[model samples]
Structures are given as C-alpha cells and as structure tokens.
Target: MYFGASASALQRLVEQLKLEAAVERIKVSQAAAELQQYCMQKACKDALLVGEPRSCALF
Candidate 1:
C-alpha cells in the first residue's frame, strides 16, 4: 500500500539522519582532541621558553 511505502521511506530518512549525526559527533570529538593537543603543546613550549621546569612537569 501507499502508506506502507511512505512509512518505509520515513524509516530510511530517519536512519540516514542518525548516521549523519553520528559522523558529526565523531568529527567534533576529533576536533576537540586536536585543540587540546595544540593547547598542551603551546603551554609546554611557553613553559620551556620561560625556564619554568615546575610548570612543565605537569605534562
């Protein structure tokens, strides 16, 4: 029936949306991790330049 076909199409759309959402989440997580790494590296470089051994010890 037409109703059954409509329901199937709706289900497919929902699944595609879910997949896209998951991909977005992964991308966001990766970006956040990269940002954290950059921040840590910058902090370490700064500490080293200032000769602050104690500050760099946290890494």
Candidate 2:
C-alpha cells in the first residue's frame, strides 16, 4: 500500500489498522520506477504512453 501522505500519517494509519507487518510504504518515485521497469520487462509498448514506453507520467 503506497501512501501519498506524510510519514507520520502513514504510521498512524498503519497502527490504527494494525497492519504494521502487512503493509509497506514507498515513495512515489520509487514505485513509478519499479512500475516502469516491470512494464519494460514485459515489452509493454503502451506501458507509459502510446509508442513511448520511456515517457511515463506515473508521478
């Protein structure tokens, strides 16, 4: 579960839900990079944009 909130907020939510060991938070940039890499590995021509696999706007 990638949260778009502050670290403190994410922590609080995790604690509230008691999912400390189940969920992990990552930066948007890192997630985007990973998504792009996975897409490339699968040869997704439209992974990012039409005919532009490298031009991702994931952020």
Candidate 3:
C-alpha cells in the first residue's frame, strides 16, 4: 500500500480497518518515485487502502 505523506497515513488506514493486530508487516514510504517503483515491481493493480475513493485509481 502507498500513503501520500508519512507513516501516520498508513497507521490511520490500519486503524480504520481495525486490523492492527492482524497485520504482520508494514512498510512506509514518503518518496513518490520510490513508491512508484515498488508498486510497479510488485504489480500492484489497485489501492487496497486509501483515504478517498477517487484515489483508488492511482494504483
């Protein structure tokens, strides 16, 4: 998953899902270029978590 700002953005997303305890791993990134590369490498086709519905298409 990619968060726009800081790790807190990811934290909030986890909190929203109420799956904090279920999450076994977490990776945080603020660099847009790095995030884009990571996502592309992972072949991430969709945003699993996002603050806004419209942002889902970003993945």
**The candidate that achieves the highest TM-score relative to the unseen native structure:** 2
The parts of candidate 3 lying over 4 Å away from their true place are 1-4, 19-59
Q: What RMSD, rounded to one decimal, does every model reach?
A: 10.1, 11.7, 16.4
Per-structure clash totals for the candidates: 0, 0, 0
Q: Write the per-residue lDDT of candidate 3 for residues 3-50, one digit (tens) a residue.
A: 466899877977978875676654555466678888877664444532
Worst 10 residues of 1 by lDDT: 49-58
What lDDT tens digits, residue by residue, belong to model 1 across residues 16-37?
Answer: 9899888744587899999989
CA lDDT, every prediction? 0.76, 0.76, 0.66
**Pick by TM-score: 1 or 2, better one:** 2
lDDT tens digits, residues 1-59, model 2?
Answer: 56578899988877978865667999999999999899887775554345654544666
Itemize residue pairs with steric clashes in candidate 2: none
lDDT of 3: 0.66
Query: Candidate 2 — what's its lDDT?
Result: 0.76
